[model samples]
Target: MQTCEVETIIQAAMPEADIDVSGEECNFTVAIISERFEGQNLMQRQKGVLALFEEPLKTGRLHALTIKAFTPAQYAEMQNTFLVQLES
Candidate 1:
């Protein structure tokens, strides 16, 4: 599936998420930030996103997806670090 299409599906699952999608047509990378991820461990957070595309994954319309999930606080920290790296 297309990157935007994949992004739309995941965003629908977590409306508050900040998402960036890139890569090949059927395989893509997704970075997601959402308040809904709060208090959830890595596995749980991953599962939450995976659940959103259970059907697409099963049908093979989507070949592969790499996901990075984080809560708002975590994402803020990460964003700051990224900005720091860019500035340096």
Candidate 2:
């Protein structure tokens, strides 16, 4: 599927989210940061996002989807961790 279509699907569900979709054809990696994930566990967050692409995934329009979903604070922390590791 096209990247824009994948992005549009996710964005429609989480209007307040910051969504990033990369890769091509039927494979994609998605990173979503939103306040909506604040109290949810990792499974809950990932499941909710994956659910948005269920139809596409089932139909093979999306073959592989790697999801990285986080709250704003979590994304900030993850970025810091990666930066620290690079510096070390």
Candidate 3:
């Protein structure tokens, strides 16, 4: 997926989120910071975010994906070192 599309999708789902999307073409790396993730675990966070691209992923419109999601506080503490990892 394109960077703008990836970013837009995430932004739509989590309007208050701070999202960073990188990589090229169909492969991407996304870091999402939101208060919505405050009480969610890593898998829960992954599910919620990945759901936004279910159709694209299934249709092959989106290829590889690397997602790291965290609450604002967590991101502040681990900005240089991700606390979790989820890949698709």
Ranking of models by lDDT: 2, 3, 1
What are the clashing pairs of model 3? 1-26
Highest lDDT scorer: 2
> Candidate 1 — which residues are off by over 4 angstroms?
83-88
TM-score of 3: 0.86
TM-scores, all candidates, are 0.85, 0.89, 0.86
RMSD of 3: 6.5
Distance from true location, Cα of 30 in model 3, Å: 0.2
Candidate 1 residue-wise lDDT at 26: 75
Instruction: Give the C-alpha miss distance for residue 65 in model 1, angstroms.
Output: 1.0
Question: What's the number of clashes in each of the models?
Answer: 0, 0, 1
Best candidate per TM-score, number?
2
By summed lDDT, the worst window of 10 consecutive residues in model 1 runs over 10-19
- Give the residue spans of candidate 3 off by over 4 A: 79-88
RMSD to the true structure for each prediction, in A, is: 1.7, 1.3, 6.5
